[model samples]
Target: MPSIHDILTKAVALHNGGQPERAAALYRDVLAVEPAEPHSLHLLGLQMRRAGCEAEGIALMARSLLLAPTLAPALFNQARALQDSGRLDEAIAHFRRKLEVDPNCGVTSIVLGNEALARGRLDEAERILRRAAALEAGGAFASRLRRALERVTTARGIARDAADPSLPPGLVVRGAFRDSSGYAHKVRQFVRHLVDAGVRVRLVDLNHGDVDNLPDGQIDPLLHTLDRPVRAKAVLSFTTPLVVEAVPNLKTINYTVFEALDIPPLWAAHSRRHDHVVVATDSSRRAWLQAGHPADRVHICPEGVEPLEPGRVAPAAILDGTGRRLADYRVRILNVSDLNSRKNLEGLLRVWLRTTRAEDDAALLLKAGKGDGASGSIRDLLARLTAETGRTLGEAAPLFLVEGKLSDTDMMSLHAAATHYWSMSHGEGWDLPMAQAGAMGLTLLAPDHSAYHAYLNGRVAHMIPSHVTPALDGYRGRDWWTPDEAAAARLLRAVIDDPDGTRLSAREHLLEHFSWRSAAHRLIGLLGGLDAL
Candidate 1:
């Protein structure tokens, strides 16, 4: 005869092992033995919900809540089920109830904000989102929230018709690839509007990667690489190298270079770099001049999110092989990044393991790309960590490694499947994925750094204090970049110990700021008006 702990542990093992039905059966058996057991009932309810039995799961969770109203898990589950069933009002009540029990529920804060958004209360939505973002200290969610707040402000500005058509055709921008992408996308929109107003626009991709499905009338690759004459009226480079390197081809009336950060080494290499440089923000411009970039060349321009299309109802690709869908991965934390020295994944793994041990049914998922020579090393390390932790590989909280580049469709599908995204990079050129996840409305854990804070603003991610050097005194891995057995165990515990209510908030954030159409328009403006401005 198995002890109660034995049975419950087995059920959790089955659930984490990708056998939800079997786990649910074990949970049911436990419930049969102890009908009012809140833990058993709650686990069973989650399994049911994961299996797409929403109503049954909701009923079970509600009953569990009745038996143990103080159970934050049950309340949170009930709320999530209600939201899944489109009962937004009821869902809000349950989320509020969960928060009432645990005010520090980061996930609940996001869900509540989403609920407010669903009710069409923009101000309430913004406030609730801001609160959620603010809770993570200086995390990705907070940065995202700041961006969201900016969007709200921008929307208001647009609504009041405060921004006018500015900049002329044939604008050029270059800089660090990521930040440049944001500005380029926005500037592209300005160009498209100009094209509609009968202006010809040319684009340049200093970054080698193809712009995913950019529409026509935008700059094509051939134009930038092949020494095509830039006949624009004005020339602007997000980085100075763009103008300095192509000065001969440029026939613009004025050459303006726009830089958002400290000047790169590439800029200093050019003597007659640019006619003028536009600085997007005052603080950033000041930093550039302080860093020795001439102050006389700087100009100020306000930056915004690349306008995106409103997300629409599309058939979400069920992540079939993973044996779990987005709905199934509820409360699961998804971390996507290259397994390298800069990421500082060990700390996140520690938090995850601790949370999982505290909660019984949690799982930590990692989706990583294979780059450099780190892939095989990471795999071997993970396997060793699992074994040392007394965890069975692919059974007791697995590490799902997805190598290689992914298409946008595949990426978005994975995004849709995640409950939360955790990123702890020491430095960020710009955490695009964090924004994408936030736009998709995923709760994020990000580091408290200037780059993330500057872009995410304050609404979408939870930011934590980061150290200049990772604390590695006790780390067993010889390399700081690799995971130690102890760290792995801690991370595993965090996922299974407690659920984060950030999933709801992530979905809501996406609906507000992430759209393809909007992104396209922004790209047009950035590229089309290079010549005139």
Candidate 2:
């Protein structure tokens, strides 16, 4: 029942699976049967190019596209060849042609924009880059294009400021919130949304934190510059009338107003000094009101998550194809968080130790991105728990540790691979990874509090069923920690025993509630309110 298309699909799969030489043969066989198949032609052509047959691959791809002008991939491949071949004019035309066919294509627009910049067509490059950014929410290529545009715009701003001398004053929001540890990358979402919605927005990130323990691309490298203080003082002198505070760093001190901007009136004071202020939280509304800044002057917009496009390539190709399931070996429960004291990893550890059924088939997998700061303490606690639990569970039941910060794409892939996503955080500002897991259709088990609860309908995710008891200090905080060792045993028994039916339903709940497109629409509505501002 398989057609030539199916066979070609398999060939593409083989190519993706790292057997490109074998894939090349299958592709050739397909071409022998149907010489004009554009998809196979384009893909094989790309493979050929990558394998060092540039001229032959370029000619084949160009011929394939000429035979089928509507094939976007072919057009893209042809543009790549043209660019490398030093035919800029032809490359630009074909790149734009790809976008004309598929306006949502990000790669084409990026290349076209980059070429435009290379040719000194700044305005055209800017327009194309912005459009491309909207299409692909997050990617290294898109990030590079955006940073390039920022550099160009900043240069122009400096030139204009020099000519005019007196400029329209403004404020730039910077700084991190208490719960914004893992979700710091989402700040770009806020800045981009504001820019696309017609607000003049600028981003200045030095990644001013310690690079020693931080993950790559998570923080800006410029922040650690030895001349940061001198540069900061200079920037402060430059933006005299315009203020910058309430942001993460104390960079621009020479500017007017040194107040932090979390909510409304607090934000409004800066807006009163300038034209507008950006607010990260709704609680800032009270601050703005107290500062006597009108609602119109303060822009209230939360950061957004732009969903990754469904991979153009299939998922089966990406997998190892060993065909193993959790039941075959130990069941791995993954918890993603930094190894920080505040994250409450200890509570989960305590719960794991008391559970009886977990002693047999379960292995706790903690994925920590941050360096091993408090890891010795955590390992010691985990070892103690394993010692107590292993009496019944056996010696093979100790927990395993895998520590490294994964990129957004790799993290999503891992979430798709996980048995269940667990979040035992004390609190989260946006909880981007949890939302991403939901979007990836993974079963999530989380604490029922803070912004996590606000995003999920309470009935959806599994909450630990326990009433608040007094803390060790006898303080009045709610008891999220399980004191009754039996409670932990009961919770584990319920989750593991009903794995199939319960897990399927939990996945269904995620598909219904958390999605990238749905989040994007919500963001659009939020931006709509800024018209009054």
Candidate 3:
């Protein structure tokens, strides 16, 4: 007894609320009373498609569109159904027809652009998406259009780069390649490997400020100065999309490293924009997968360390801040970190003071960088530690804070001076310093979890006994490991007592599996495979 309008409204509510069968019956009743009702026909067709009757759904939608020739929703739905069925050409035509009926429909333009991209028609996709962006300006649809447009632009650039003869024919490496960050070191090492392998390579410096300060033979200005299109068979982007917008037509790979248990949702969103992702370790890959990234798209590419020359020894004497030589300590333990709470420096201090005696002539060399935003200053840390331990700074406590920039040679020399290297970090993306120390033949005492598991093991390094605990600092809601102080103290004693055997084992393991040469070979193979695809 209900009016056709009331019936259709109830059917729409039922359909949206997941009562498709009931909705279908109501729609049928509406159609029976008014057979030419376009809305009823369109709603019923969508319900059929949801129920897996693609052919029936398409036929119903076609009939509805015939009755109401300018029904935008019906036209869009028909195009979507065709797309889902893999009939891209037909789907694109129907989408174009839908846009003709509703020229301002941002959704249709986005769909059509995606269809064009999937069909390898980059030019058409870019044109359609740009139009969508203009029409949907200053709204959520505009944001989506912008993202799609970036993808299209990047695709076009890559295609043009591939065809350009002036640029190198091999892979293009783009990142802050000359910076002091761990990512920079990784990029430089990988690029070196590619060059050694006879791969025609090109390096693009994303951090333009660091260009002038780079070491000699580091930056190839000739390649950067070329006036041709930016082309490469593949692009290994170590930076983010915001830094190097697009690399058209190439298999773009994002090399990401996160030093936490959960990858920030924002980072995960950015990562999804790439064709593939390369993480530093299996743990990083797992974190990304847990963050809802597709498993097949994320890969484990563990970082490598530069092997030290044979017979490299610790410096016998290094200058203190006052430029005075202070190398008379019996055993020196070293910790190099960014001085954040996540590094567990407080815990390390507590364990060190409790385990070793001041009379043991043992010195703890704390080579720390400027603190993170949340961390207090080094003077504050020293004051707090002094208050906690009731030991005065200089002669009373064996902790010495070393803060300054050290060149690569100086860093190697510093490593040589240390009797042992230690870290009590809650987590790490790759633990670059620990790997470097191990490669330099320094015995390492660190937590066994996180990225350390990729290279460090019982045979090579002292694996601190630890248990998973709720993360501290800004990393709340996530989990990180806490090393048992008692176990760490014991390992510290073990390393100091048998430094020779421990260092030998650590060095052999690093040289065998974690060398830069091996990592480069693996990267080349992966690039070649992606190119073939």
The CA lDDT at 90 in model 2 is 80
lDDT of each: 0.52, 0.52, 0.73
Task: Report the Cα lDDT for candidate 3.
Answer: 0.73
What is the Å distance of residue 57 in model 2 from its true position? 77
Name the best candidate (by lDDT): 3
* TM-score for each of the candidates: 0.45, 0.46, 0.65
State the weakest 10-residue window (summed lDDT) of model 2: 228-237
lDDT of 3 by residue, 103-124 (tens): 9988888777765664447788
Instruction: Order candidates by lDDT, high to low.
Output: 3, 1, 2
- lDDT at 222 for candidate 2? 31
Lowest summed lDDT window (length 10), candidate 3: 207-216
Best candidate, TM-score-wise? Answer: 3
Clash numbers, per candidate: 90, 15, 9
Higher-TM-score candidate among 1 and 3? 3
Q: 209-315, model 2: which lDDT tens digit per residue? A: 33443344544433222111111101211121212322112122211121112222222333454334443334343345455666765444333344444442122
RMSD of each: 24.8, 22.6, 11.9
Query: What tens-digit string does per-residue lDDT give for candidate 1 at 1-533?
Result: 99878999999999889998889889988988989888888889888877657678888888889899989988988887776564656877888889899988767887666544323345776787777776866864665556445444432332222122352323343222222133444444334444455444444433323234333333433333422223344443443332222223342221222222333333332312444454434544554465466666544443333222335423244442557543454465567666654565644543443334322344455666532344576656656555555544444443445555443445556666665677756454445566666666556665655345544544655555543433232221112122243434443344344445332344354444444444334444543453333
